[model samples]
Target: MPFPSRPVAKPQLRAHSKYPSIPSPSATYLVPNTSDPVGASLGGVRVVNEGLVGIGRLSGENVDKFGETQGAASGLYITDWAYASGQFSGKFNVLPDRGYGDGSSNYAARLHEVNFTFTPYYGTSVVPQTQVQATYVDSTKFTYQDGATVKFTTGLNPDTVGGVVGARTGSLFGQTVGLATAANGPDGAQESLLSFDAESVHLFPDGSGYVSDEYGTYIARFDATKKITGLTQLPGAAQPNRPANTPNFDSFTAPTTGRRNNQGLEGMSVTPDGARLFALLQSATVQDTNGGQQQTRNHARLFVYDIAGANRENPVAVGEYIVRLPQIDLNSDGSGLDGTAAQSEIIALGPDSFLMLPRDGNGLGKGTTVPILFKSVQLVDFASASNILGQFDNVGQAVSPAGVLTPGVNAAATAEVINMLQQDDLAKFGMNTTIPANSNTLNEKIEGMALVPDLSTEQPNDFFLFVANDNDFQSSDVKMLNAAGQVVSRGDGRLNAGITNDAMYYVWRLTIDAGAKFFRMDVADAP
Candidate 1:
């Protein structure tokens, strides 16, 4: 997959839409705000009466329960995409990073199709009219390099989670992993469940696409029925190289470096033509880090898969590049690591260029001592740099720094289009220097992003950028604990300092003038 070069065009941010500058410092920032337009559309997506097109949501009202989850609100780390739904018109598709259920239960491990009905503003609350759900059929069909077939997600001990369920042998292009063959998880947790920890999904026109995961950096396929049809691994992402550590794999051990644990393949996008699918590593993978801590290793590994038509059943590894993430405020010592960031969501602006969201782990404005800060959605162009596909694709390699193309690592060219950080105006909402109840920013797992069509306008270029967050199906109680029996505090330890998981969903939208202008390249398809 060859990405064409593009003339540099600087992006300008008009003005912050009239949404709430900051969520109420005293209210629960629920998702979808399904009941009314107050929260859902406030400072979010509004179909405006743009010139002659008049294709934006006007004052309107509607009643629909945005969407709901099945389990404890503690795990819905919605790291899916907001990309236009490939199945139907006027619909947008969203996926979730559903954590695999424990060995004792299967409720949390299911995959479902999430879609929303788009309606322009009329007069009342303008929220999606409907929320649809369908069970995703897991794809157990896989052909490995050694001619051995691995039935992914086959019946296995739940206790043994996050293992290399299936992978390529020596014959494949990127399976020369340099790590150990086994997986590492909790003491009793099985290190053998090679199931797909589906983190992000990108769909094609024909209703087919790839679902990426954290387990083995697996790139799996889901059919129109939302069932996983077939699956494969990134060129070098196989068992041995997929750091044995379970969960985030965030902690690396040697040649087996991979996407950090918890922070797996969180963001994925497909070109409009469905020729190339791109996936972003939430953070720098073990192989990409220059032996630095979280803040130091900011290069995000972007993988490109070249496919044909809407059905990307067999995508060839065409290109891979590095996107450097902007660092956040540091702690006094700098060693304690005060800030958090991950390349959670990404959408293609055009071929070789995409919009990515990088945010800290603090749930919105997390601390009273530190000024509240939220996530930033950014657009980057990767046209000029040489492809670093082979260097770190193998196990023994390390990702070079962002600007410098070290001997083994080749740097990718990237230019920032817009940094959402500058657009902050949360002070009015009471989320500035001091934090208060309900005082927060975007949801923590701000992962899902999609370029939805502006049905209001017949113009293809008109579209909306839909960004959503994973509530983690969280509850107000202490849901997790550390080994010493202590509560594990998240983001400044304040849970929006008070926001409840049962709170409603907040769906925001931004109008992209030519969103319909599919990012493309003039060069021939990948070889």
Candidate 2:
């Protein structure tokens, strides 16, 4: 129904050629407007060529459809994504189905869909080309509170259905014992279910979507055949609770105050006139960090919702800000600020702006040789921020307790739009940003982001973006499934013995500066 104004289709030109031809736009991939640091701190925002046009790849032993190992094994891959533009067939991308799976158990939180095709070369010569291409196509899973689709168990157990108990409770890293759901017996009597750790996603305009959860940092609302109709619950300062309001979907305990056990709600985004819905925080919470330092978790927290009426699944938490992130120098030399480049995905672009990303967790499937010093994307801007929704939605309310910011707050305004570790724009596309990393380097979770428009009737205001990657599934060729979706194992146990990370993608382009009031998203071009 909305968001996808064209420019994605391209790939079908055959005539005595073996692909790789496309090319045209290149003014040497244009990008220097004095290298916009978000147009020198938001004075209208122009990028138009961090332009690496397109590149995509999926293999790492692809598989999906219960044969398991889709983007390689171990927490599977693509931790967040969404794209659309496929009415009669051709441009897709959804990815979320792989939450508590690879670390074992707690399965059932699905969302697969992939179809992709893009092409785009607009070259000034970027050697390694792929121009986007996906294909897995179908999966839906999620249904909880006994609508069926059960199993959920990662350990702390308390889900029991036909034997009573059921409200929630399931852990993955927060082990309390040697559990593989403890052989499914005692522990409130088994049956099990409810653990979901999806991460982030947002799609709407009739196909219904919105899935954010690092386990009970919950935001569910599925439909379009993906089931789970509605649930929002975030605020209790982003819930983990411990023993206070009780939730705690343990990523290894340490809760007592919300989100920071594996930092919840990774990043979600809606607005392109879908009327707001943001939700970030892949860091800072647990009473807004200070001693849990990593540069004090760089403040984080974003949230904002008001899903444009008809009770879009009860989403109404107006605003809340605090965006700091970006701390780096984890021994990259001048040594001091030890990490917190946190933030992983987001895109919005109006209703107060968006586009986050933030990175660095070392490169190529993280067997870490360090060196990735901050990836980019940035440009937050809650129009002069400082909302703190109803004074920090509870749980020892902190907004930055000791690490600062809470003296009349303010926060938001970031800026840096796209530098994804440039390195000659990723060595003109053959990737590899350096560090001992090889297999084409560049990937230690760039998460997922989307954007679209470049329907270009002479560049209406450009746009494209895209980005992606979350290959934590570190594949060495994989297949694994067992929790009874069957296919039990085929590889991935050399402990990433020779690293494999495929599923990457990056597009970039950008423009939007006709004085920037940006909105564009009712989509309609392709015909």
Candidate 3:
């Protein structure tokens, strides 16, 4: 059967150049003629390279109509220059047997989501189920892979997996998982997820690459069935070089707990050469000893992992740095106040560096009128990241009230990272120097980021940026940016428009190829 697809209308586009360029400059765009005067202005040149090339929503006709279609639209694998759209097929089995405690069904392991497309050079993509047990309640931390359909779910300490729904197997929890016949609900009552957390897969010419998490953990390898290739509990800058036995898993020392309660890693992006890895971390602590429960502790940090060294078993953190602002309070809920967890999702811009989108906190900015100024994507040097394993004895460093930048290899090169965070850099593209009005509306959780190839220009690095926003139809604001972090494009408003901003939730992964082909599978709104 044909998979479902959604078309975006008036698809928003912003930029800093007269046209989209490779390695987009650190700038903003001009404002469009819209209803709200204080709204974001658009700038530079707006270019729509390709439109509706592929679809990335869950199966089922009326699935969750509130999510943007998940799929790739730009990047290295440009399928056709002729502008012709591409197509592919996959399966999602509906499981009815799995049930949550509240008289509702869940789509955990019995039937995970499976979907994939091809890249110009790397034929068929192969992403099997990585984390089987993760798909339990409608609310667990399950990620979608080549064979899985649930999108990447991050944040929220006690993660839940309730939305995954698909084909059912007669076995679960080590028993023969079976499917039920009834549907469940609290909010996205259907659906399920794979076994992994935030993950990135590189489809090598031979389908062999490492699939690691933020904490530098290589959970599994991607072969035919997403095989259980290797595991390193003690993952870091070092290589353990241990052979995999049955149920193999590593046990590296966590950078947190060991230190001043300062290490919690998330967001892992590998270099093109696969020699280095970059990680983003969220550190939490109470600024004032007498504040309320959630207010007393919260901090966020960024670190780098150098794999080129010899000690594989104990890879040390070679670089470290802090991206903070005086008025930027991590402890405050959306209001930029005190005592909030300043969170961020990271992605690699190139081999030399990466970018971070730090969300101030979970506050709605309703009561207090604190401007949300911590939503910019700051660029940073990969080499300059201090070794968490080496420094502070692998016992992660504390991110104090004043965010710190513990220089790594190329501290001087931080200009690129800082420029992307500048208000002027964003203004060039006609974008608001501050956070957009409803910054947190669509979960504002940017999990995956990829650059779309635009060869017509002199620079090839300036590709398009596609962020994976998890809130399905509820907040269908899958942000599109130029290489420089400008709001150049927005999700298709068609399938996502008219729906209440809260109608859906969760957009997991965002993948792109040279052919302008893309894939973005959602764990919540699969219809």
Query: Would you estimate the TM-scores of all the predictions?
Result: 0.60, 0.33, 0.44
Writing each residue's lDDT as its tens digit, candidate 1 over 144-215 gives 222343212311122212443223222222322111122221122222233344566665546655677664
TM-score result, candidate 1: 0.60
Ranking by TM-score: 1, 3, 2
Model 3 residue runs over 4 Å out of place are 1-196, 199-205, 208-221, 233-264, 284-303, 306-343, 361-374, 382-388, 394-443, 456-458, 472-527
Query: Ten residues in a row with the worst lDDT in model 3?
Result: 32-41
Clashing pairs in 2: none
Q: RMSD in angstroms, all models?
A: 12.1, 21.8, 15.5
For candidate 2, lDDT tens digit of each residue in 69-159? 5552111223223333442223444454343233354344565667666656655556665677677777656554343333332323234
lDDT of each: 0.42, 0.60, 0.28
Task: Give Cα distance to truth, residue 327, candidate 2, Å.
Answer: 28
Off by over 4 Å in 1: 1-92, 100-193, 237-256, 309-311, 330-340, 364-371, 401-441, 458-460, 476-498, 502-527
